[model samples]
Target: MTANKIIFYPDNKEINVDQGTGILEAAIMAGVHINSPCGGKGVCGKCKVRIKQGRVETKTVGLLTKDEIDNGFVLACGSISLTDVEIDIPTSSSISREQILTQEAKVEHMEGIISRLDAGDSEGKEVFIHTPLVRKLHLTIPLPSLDDHTSDLERVYREINKLTGLEDISTKLSTIRLIPEILRDNNWQVTAIIGDGKLLSLEAGNTSHRNFGLAIDVGTTTVVVSLIDLNTGMIIDTEASYNRQAHYGADVITRIIFSRNKQGLDKLHQLIIETINDLILALINGHQIQQNDITAVTCAGNTTMLHLLLSITPSHIRLEPYIPVVNGMPLINADETGIKINPHGLVACLPHVASFVGADITSGVLASGMYQSDEVSMLIDIGTNGEIVIGNKDWLVCCASSAGPAFEGGGIKAGIRAMEGAIQRVEIDPMDYTVRYNTISEVKPIGVCGSGLIDTLTEMLRARIIDQSGNINESIPSKRIRETENGLEFVLVWKEDSGTLLDIVITQSDISNLIFSKGAIYTACVVLAGKIGFDINDIERIYIAGGFGNYLNIEKSIMIGLLPDIDRDRYKFIGNSSLTGARFCLLSDKAMKIAEEIASKMTYIELSADVSYMYEYTGALFLPHTDMGRFPSVQL
Candidate 1:
């Protein structure tokens, strides 16, 4: 096949691709970040590029205004080059991996044991003491003598066995080299940081008080790291950042396709490591602690993320049967994984149940305590993918639905990840149709996030600005509801009021995407519940988990049919349950065992194989739902 040379402006990056190649694909291959929130499906219209001196064949230009089409503006994902051409990619159209949502401010809502203990509640204080996966032991040994002379490594191992009363532990060669010096430098008095089967480090002096571990929630859209003091199991601080892998694609499916190439896996692996390293640097610097003081890391994420972190190919994850390399991963050395922590530190990944349902769900199940409850309980983890777990102590069943990235603020015009300047809430006046909203930290609006999108959609439905089908009412007598280049859009913030120069608006297409996302979530819940011979109302409690769940409004979530119409009292919002589960496993051996049990015991139901799931999804495509009886509380 003949190749064509395409030159990108501003950065002046050039790449050669086969004839008829989409510009967005070329940008991806050339290591360029183009913001295509729909993953190059040609629906988002976010990857707008201007042609400088070339002609291209466009499959669809509906996203662009007539003026824009005349002015050489086109959607990169929708355009194919007819010849060698030059194009200008705008900064607004570039994907910013740094914009990931990472604030732990909302973690106060977490219902885990750690949060209760940190609050100093009497019930928690009476129940148990903090126990971490890594234990620190202080040891004093006699100086080298004929009768008592023992190798430094063996001496340390002996002391560890005496303290923990366990045999057959593995030691890293790196720890062996440090044992001789760390033991002798402190006059044979040293602290051994150890886990169940691995020796992390041997530090000089009685450094038992300095032991620490990190609990990470590695979401497809964001990465959250929590620094926990091992001695007390208290979260000292947290750091969150956008996942750098987002530059390749917003969802795991896109990344799975990207990994099919030879260097793609390595590139993704490096990006995630950099993201983790960046968070590690921030936590250490913020706390004024040395990197060596950190002993272990517990990571909770989906199956694909675990594969990418381990530099394993995830191509098969999206294939037939959707089988992954392994649902449960073994302990990996920090150095082997390129994690910027103690060289001998252990990085443990929580086990996953299936390809779609992963460690994050297992962690959420563990954190929610739904597994131990006698009454029926359900968990909904809403993110790029929606994972639903339904059951109680007796039995558990789960399923995953491709909810897309709409809820994470992808696939929408003027949409951004949950960040400081992103709008978190919304209220629309019924009479005037004027919009009122609040941004994170009271910052000027840059874009609307997931919560804000739900609120807006609900309010629009109530105010009659949008119908049950999610179509904008063009006849509405309001300035906020007006037609735009991308069909009819409701303007939330004018150019003067927004942080950016452009007007922040929600389009009809954005509403459609969100509806599809919500429909998938609700359908998954119904399908999982039906599989267990139960109705949605049979759920005694509904636990919402994830970063988006932190700020989620129950009323609005139900109003949009994203959640079931159960009594408000039955709904519980547990912020970042995945991270909470990771922390629980990090601090409690029992919690880790429970996590494994959850992964093994939970039944994974493939929704694609279920014939009824399609009917449920189509029914949920309307505002609230096609069956008004399912959502009695929702009034429109």
Candidate 2:
């Protein structure tokens, strides 16, 4: 096998790969980020790059234009290095880390929960004690004499029992071997790390104050890791980045399909592990914390993500019956899963309700306090899949809709992730059909993101550039609204004003994709509520979770029918509730228990099996709905 050197321009980074390696694979090896929403299968033309120098063999040009092909543009996923190659990764195809979504909303509520747990207040109910998944206790064992000498391990266990009131603690033989040396060298005083009824490790002297844990949210698109101080339940720092498993696929179904290929599961698992390890390393290094001091990690993610994280086969998850390997995962050592934390540190994943209704939803339910609410509340997490949960203190029901990745910038003509320079907001004047837009970080516009797409659809509808059926109204007569070879498109930004120096337009096809995405989400909410014989408007509150949900304009979302049309006050944004729930479980044993109970109590309604789902989904395909009576608030 011949190894060829590939150089990526602008960054000037280079790597050596086998001669037949795909340009996308070579870039991955070089630690370069490229947008491949279809996971380097050449189905999506997002991995475009210019052949700056040397020979390359391309299997397909994909969506590249004739001019682009003439100018050396080829899909990186489809091109392989025939010789030493120099590739120019375009700005539009590069992934940016500057604006990754990490900030969470509803901080005061989380703070209140923490305060209540710390004060042991349950409002006349069972108190959720502040027992973190991992705890460190400093103990001074009385010196062992022959007259009353218990075995060294038993002596340590006795002291632990006295301190923690836990009688049946267990530990590994390796930890038992270290007890004698650790206890004697520290003059009979040592700190014991206990996690999930087991002694994880023993350290000399008082290391109790240095205890830390990680709360992780592994989304299909992004991975967030938060370092927390176990003693105080304070979040030290958080770091987030695009999930590298995205190199394989954009959604769980695609990844699940890929996992059936040779070593595909291993590859996906390794990519996610690497992504998590990198984030964990960033958090630990930034805070000057030792890896050993971080004793536990609590993870919350969709079922597929959790499966990939634990190296479990997820093929069954997307099969006919849609069964998962396990909805309730057992606690295991972090090293067993290749997470780069303390070797003996424990890892716990929040429970899942079903194949699609995963731990992320359970975590959201816990974080929203919807399960304990007296009034009915709804929780919707908008991503590649739209997960909806509706119920109150007495009951809960959930269903997942395959909303696709249109919201996350997949399957759109001029779409990208919500990163710096991506257009995130838009407005159009009805008088002249002129457009106004705001990019993330106020930088030069590169492309449109989920929120920007939603805003664009709403503004276009308001400006009458597009009708309710998501068809472009060409008769409006504006230079921005022009017919291209692909179809009619409405330009949001001219090439001169764009960061990529390309006109960013929303095509008729993009409009249709957005409509389908919104329809799926809206229909899921309606169907789930209707399943329980309740109207969507009957819910007292709607809590929106996930990073994409955080930036959503409630008015625009309802206008486009992505969200249900209800009282504006009923909507509340609880950003990244999955991560929040993971943090709660990490900090409170009672929260973890509650998460499990929520998973078990909730009933999963499979929408695909429902006979009325298609009927309701078809009705929702139009702006708001074909049934105008359902969207009285959207009087367009």
Candidate 3:
């Protein structure tokens, strides 16, 4: 056996390794996480290392070019050292920080989540920090004498320019009109909140102390806010509450319909912004943070949320040709945008790729880190709108699916988010048919979360509780199976334990929606694979990305054909990839460039417009798919 020293260039640290081990294997053995988007399968080619000196074996490369191979840029997962050598690892956030990739299976939620799945949190009280996506700052400028005769506006720009070194500043007519009066009133000492380098708001004088910004993610049923320190980009406080838009409807289509009515759009917009401002106040008081300190904001939501947030009409987007008033918009001042962010702050929204696939997909694409590679890769943001991205450096193809809120515990009688009291994951006794579970708070069960929903669906299917066609199998001997006003359901919780127990059964209607939703996503996966002639097996690594992805069971997900049938080892659940990506974008300009590049290179495949999609979707209605041979491991 040849002797080898596995050298890590991070902090210039080095470790010795046996000759046969690959760099990734050795790195894992050494506890170094060198950003592998493909879970170190060599398909993504992201884990590239420069071999200063070494010889090694390779696994396989579906992406690396001849020039790259010749230049000694090797895929870490595929290469095994045949001799002693040095490798230079790049600086990746995954390597430099305390990376939390998986959402602990059971995290504490406030309500509507833990009890149904019978879960309990062991992670302890979440240590929260307020980190506004944007911050507003006030600066005091000294009055100019005869020696400094520069124009007031020019003089103001000088102060900010000298302070931040940002040139080519831009602002609205509203802010520009008030500049002179504000400058003189504060004796040239003023506060200004900048958004994407543009001056958003300005006040009387030096009011810089209370800087703050709000980072928001708008879901169909919920909205989350993180109040932050804009200067330091630290999240000082966070508050999440259900999206009041639920009253309009549970999903985007309903909300879009709501947007079409006269005052419906205005009401929807007002309610959300009001909710944002309310959360901002609570967070500011909760953490003793200054609201005026917030100067800028960044929001990640579906297209509908962005449209509603902007008070733009979104009904046309639901129709054919699927055009939006604006797919992506530039930065606007907080006052104009009506966000809870500091009035002086700027509100910067993420770019949207399409109507169905919006900023959330862009955020997920950035978060997945697939854009930084030259290999073939895929990023799937599973939510009400299931956005799928397939490509690497050479090409990218995208498609959107209506996966629905079922994955997030919606539509079901007792379903919730991955918050304080939700039951997240579950396992059932095949014989006795009893249940054991984990929840968010480690408290008594109340309702189910996303993971529990998938677990229940999969378990019910395997136990023959539900059939291939998603039919409730009432013919079983269990008393828990019964009919209701809403149709069939299996009794999960007794009446005493739950608020209502008509037996929280998976209904025929619910099954149809679930199947249709899951089928759309599954169909897109197959169609994209067919478009490139790559089988699901060809995907060496499968990243189930997003907040929901972290808690989803791959086995069950595959068994139900929500995802492809691959080795459990091939899948990596990346929790909150969108937020992580947005955070990175906020933190580093380099990360922002990467996001733009990802958006530009990605080719969107229109499912509604595609002719073959209907056929593919129809074929995917059965459990584990209508084509059983596609699923090799399923015993049922």
Candidate 4:
């Protein structure tokens, strides 16, 4: 009945587990994060641990070579402790908060974003003036007299009507309670934050200059927030962090499944709110601003994320029919949604196209200006769930594919988000098989990121280290490409050269996962185009939208078949278009209207229902693609 002591090195942290408990389970119970991208299914072969001095039984030593098995290496998930043991948890198996893609990447594009919204173009020449969704109107009222004694609330409403030219405006009970005091104390002078016939708040004095709004991009893995000066349509500050819900699950479907348990939905909801408020608090404290100064917020996320944010039931989003509770949500107050902004501040949840293709994609289309462009264009959001929109001003078609989290460092061994010390770029010398990698901030590589993964795949293919089938070529004469116990892996950085003090490698399994992910994305694009009676080349321009695209090399992306083999000029890396679109809606009601219109105009194509989709996906599973003719530029 005694517990087996499992000592993990070199940290020497010890956790006692029951005799039959797996090493991965013990690690989890010990508050350790091991790379189990397949959710510990024992298929990824990522959680390999060296049993230094342990008596354990392994059901299956997956992907390990004879030497590795002899050296006492076994899959953590496949091994169960039988006696007291000491194990070495390799650096490749640990998940740390060292390097995650957050706010740093957005800073470089802030001015460009501001200029685009201000000038309507990248050149910053012609200014596009527009009204924000939330407007602060200063009002003055005459003292109550016998001749005209109108109620304080009625007087304010009358003035608001005169200013906004609208009838049937609504005010919250919280705003109503403070109306008399605010009017009387300020001598009948006030500023009102009004949007879409809703009086979000009424201030005692003229606080119009201090009015602000938040534009948010609620990504599955990360969340970005932008604080804007609503008065001048300028972004004051921006913040980002990892989504707190990621602890529950990495992707939306996993989250949806996790939310089905008792109190699961509430926990997920609270986590996202906490994540957002943390960012808000950072912005407020850092910039010396008050939460009340923020009058409104607009959030852009997938339907599930949007649902989870509002605590809406997302069980059906994963089940048959895949219908969401609501696609277009009405404006709700911050207090009601538990956002720490002004109690009366409106939280305007943007309209979504469908269950999978939510407001993020819709807002992205609007932000990219593709909704109004006459020429054919496409927007591909590369992430855990890859969403694609292909169309122009006249019409639009969209689809969502399960690309897994390989690109965002979810499933790969030694994979990390785009942060400092993460390898963001990779190049291989064909002659010597020497590998050169660049980290995000020129630090030692802890893991390879999405861009670096693509670069590695392309470079490896070009160097003949891996064939089109994504299998490592053992026949190739290269020390870097060696057959490991867990299959062949190309070592990018040695233990001495890496930040983790463990070799950074991409295994054959990692290559397969990457291939499947990139294949899903590329196939989704091709299938969407084919359904439109157009080839992949027929699209005039392909706009790659995401923060991840900021580090993407168009040639390398195409070389890996993540993107289509089209003219490089036609590829536009519009960084964080979802956030950009949300900001557009935050600053301009017209843009908000356009976002709704884009959502309405888009035709969501469910790939699961399409027969041709599976075929295209199978064909795209190879390097570049099964159809070599499509990728003419790919020499391999």
Say which candidate scores most in lDDT: 2
Model 4 worst lDDT run, 10 consecutive residues: 96-105
Q: lDDT per model, in order?
A: 0.83, 0.87, 0.66, 0.82
Model 1 per-residue lDDT at 299: 96
Deviation (Å) of 307 in candidate 3: 0.9
lDDT tens digits, residue span 1-636, model 3: 656887776545566777787777787666555644334545444466767787778766554445446666678878888887787764321232111111221121222112111232232312113223343456767677899888767776777888878699877788889988888876777877655667777877655556655667776555666655556555565566556555445677777887798698998898678767776777778776666656666777778888998898889889888887886577676778787655666676777777877777777776555554555566777765577887765676778876666666555445555655466767767676676767665655656767777787788787887889999887887777777655777766554554222223445766676777778888888888777788767766566776677667778888888888877786766555555555555544455555666666767777666777788888799887888998898879
Better of 2 and 4 by TM-score: 2
Worst 10 residues of 1 by lDDT: 120-129
- Per-residue lDDT of model 1, residues 577-602, tens digit only: 88888988888777788899999999
Q: Model 4: per-residue lDDT, tens digit, 1-636?
A: 768999887667889888989898887677565655554567666677889996999977655656457778888888999999899866555544333424343552354556666556853322335677778899997778898889878888889889778788888787899888888999889998887777877988898888888999888877888888888887887778777676555678878988886598998899789889988998899888999989889999999999999999899988888899999998787788988888777788789988899999998898788877788998999867799999988999999988888998876876777777789888899889898888877877878888889999999999988899999998877778788656788899987898755678899988999999999999899899898899889899898888787778998888888889988999888788888888888887777777888898899998878999888889898988888898999887
TM-score of 3: 0.72
What lDDT does candidate 3 reach at residue 94? 23
- For model 3, the superposed segments whose C-alpha errors exceed 4 Å read 1-148, 167-210, 416-422, 442-447, 471-475, 483-488, 496-502, 588-594
How big is the positional error of residue 209 in model 1, measured in Å on the Cα after superposition? Answer: 2.7
Candidate 4 ranges beyond 4 A from true positions: 1-104, 107-113, 122-129
Residue 111 local lDDT, model 1: 37
lDDT of 3: 0.66
Q: TM-score: which is higher, 3 or 4? A: 4
Query: Of the candidates numbered 2 and 3, which has the greater lDDT value?
Result: 2
